[model samples]
Target: MAVALSTLVEEANRYLNCAAISDYCPNGLQVEGRPQVLRIVSGVTASQALLDAAVEVNADLILVHHGYFWKGEDPCITGMKQRRLKTLLKHDISLLAYHLPLDLHPDVGNNVQLAKQLDITVEGPLDPSNAKVVGLVGSLAEPVTARDFSRRVQEALGREPLLIEGSAMIRRVGWCTGGGQGYIDQAVLAGVDLYLSGEASEQTFHSARENDISFIAAGHHATERFGVQALGDYLARRFALEHLFIDCPNPI
Candidate 1:
């Protein structure tokens, strides 16, 4: 029913292959807590709301896709950062986070999970030349209009995504889960009829139009909800520990 905190962290790090991926933030165990863990709380981000929810549930550890101490963040812990850290330290709840690793993992990665959710059969990486790109190229069983695909995305993510509709039937598709509009060009190069990402930039629309590819910008939070839940369920089954996923929804 219980596992050591260190043991859990080690297995998670190994399972996600965290060390091999370079990320903006640390991959595992951002904060240390009690030696033994009985219950785990997982969320998309380690925001104060999620921490409060975790505390309310008396979780021994908090697992998330996004955690503190990112690259280029101010070293000083003040204000919001201070409050979040205080809550974790006050409750002695370990913080386990994985950024790129969770997105890149073959089974539980965000892109793969999203493909499963959208009924897209994954083909390969979005860019064959780039190993660092976390997106994937996939295909629907049949071609559908851009609007229909948009509806599918809205239905699955529970949010209306911004669509830059092109005059193309969506069949071969490409997607990345979080803030991956930057990879649209890569998706284009891969010859996808539609490309989906969590957030879209100003230039993304132009790329979709000029390249004759449909583009969808689903909310970053909505798109990334699957991976952490999958990872949490996996750890729960693997270690026989109770796991709960708390969704502190973010519109963006």
Candidate 2:
């Protein structure tokens, strides 16, 4: 049996528990498509490559971490923006996106999934006040050297991670899966031995040295792929719809 696009989106919103807050873009059903959805495609970003892959698979719905209609973007649809939307609309493929909700979900979130893959048991959120915070505080099953942890991240994600080791061995760790170098301070204050994130800025090295916290920059796209894949699998099982996760290699 095929699932309705509206039904799948409603189920996702409830399962992710995303109805509480105001988001930059609409969380579900950004573009209308066929009434009955049989195949679903998931990806990190709704780029042209992803869209093309979804089209190739004849996906009725496309779910992504990054979607259209960001806060600071121009409302006028033209150029690349028009092209993306035009492709989805022309192909009758619905677009469903979950941003912060997907990032913070305890089970299927990027941080939690990354931690699980690394054999880290999540203790709690790094920031208690902000429920939307993507970083998580967790402890390793056993203490491991910072160098070993760095290599493990590289091996798990299939990308060499940039590591800035501190004096301490890593057991307690904090991680945010994508572009989350800013959360290092929170991790340091939380008394974690290491801070892991997808991307690092020029100042992250200085922050790591001064703050005495080990830092690791695993590839942004590599670290973030797990959560959406988990979510897609859950959705597929729940609704019995066909789901595929398409990975687009991103260096940064």
Who wins the TM-score comparison?
A: 1
Q: Scored by CA lDDT, what does every candidate get?
A: 0.94, 0.90
Using all chains and alpha carbons, the TM-scores for the candidates as numbered come to 0.99, 0.97
Angstrom error of the Cα, residue 213, model 2: value is 1.4
Q: Write the per-residue lDDT of candidate 1 for residues 17-130, one digit (tens) a residue.
A: 988888888899999999999999999999999999999999999999999998898999899999999999999999999999999999999999999999999999998888
Count of backbone clashes, every candidate in sequence:
0, 0
Model 2, 166-192: lDDT tens per residue?
999998999898888988888888999
Once fitted onto the true fold, the runs of candidate 2 whose alpha carbons sit more than 4 angstroms away are none
Off by over 4 Å in 1: none
What are the clashing pairs of model 2? none
